[model samples]
Target: MLPPIYTWLKASNAVKAIIGNTPRAYRPGDAPQDVTQPYVTWALVAGVPDNQLSSTPPSDRYTVQVDCWHTTDKGVEDLAKAVRNAIEPNAHLTAIPVNNRDPETKLYRIALQFDVLQTR
Candidate 1:
């Protein structure tokens, strides 16, 4: 099954308000070069099937990384909060792997990781 990060985030009206319409949320390498800030990008970083002793695995666990970016620190933080509120109920937030400003671009980024269990 397809990792549900994209679908779940896009389905949130709160996320849409922050990032605008379709295409604001993107997979790595898919966002346009001139894409606006205060957007989000996500990727499935790892996965493993839930092994069972006697039957086929019933679910799979995935770790997804979500990054929120904006030119201003407050803007990026707001976007990150919106993202967490949108998805935290369905998935466990494993960690905040990155919270920094890119030196070259001067963009604020907050990267969050979530552990999601999906039924196979």
Candidate 2:
């Protein structure tokens, strides 16, 4: 299932506001030992709606999903932390889950979900 369009838009806007204005850099000489390469790139994927079911009635809740891609594990973790820090500070943001994908290759992708409460 997917979240509603409005939820997606809100989440996308939040992510863009957090990441798009942040300053970042890549120093070739400051590369970590675990990372063989001297470069890293990070980007936040557009928010998507994730459908979720409720245990009680026929009601459902929507989740906003965002993905972050990095060239190294450290970079991915850093970005994930940044995302959590960015969203958790908002009073409207209820819950957030950050997941690390398996198959550790040259590229790492972190999936972030920010759940919004349906009721007050």
- For candidate 1, which ten residues in a row score worst on lDDT? 1-10
* Model 2 CA deviation exceeding 4 Å by range: 1-61, 91-105, 118-120
lDDT of 2 by residue, 23-98 (tens): 2212224334564322223222233333447543333344555455566677777665665555454313433344
Q: lDDT values of the candidates?
A: 0.88, 0.44
Pairs that collide, model 2: 1-51, 2-51, 3-49, 3-50
Q: What would you estimate as the lDDT of candidate 1?
A: 0.88
Each prediction's TM-score versus the true structure: 0.93, 0.40
Residue-wise C-alpha lDDT for candidate 1, range 1-120, written one tens digit per residue: 747777777888888888986738888898889888778989999999999999999999999999999999999998999899889988999999999999988999999999999898
Model 1 misplaced regions, further than 4 Å: none
lDDT of 2 at 106: 47
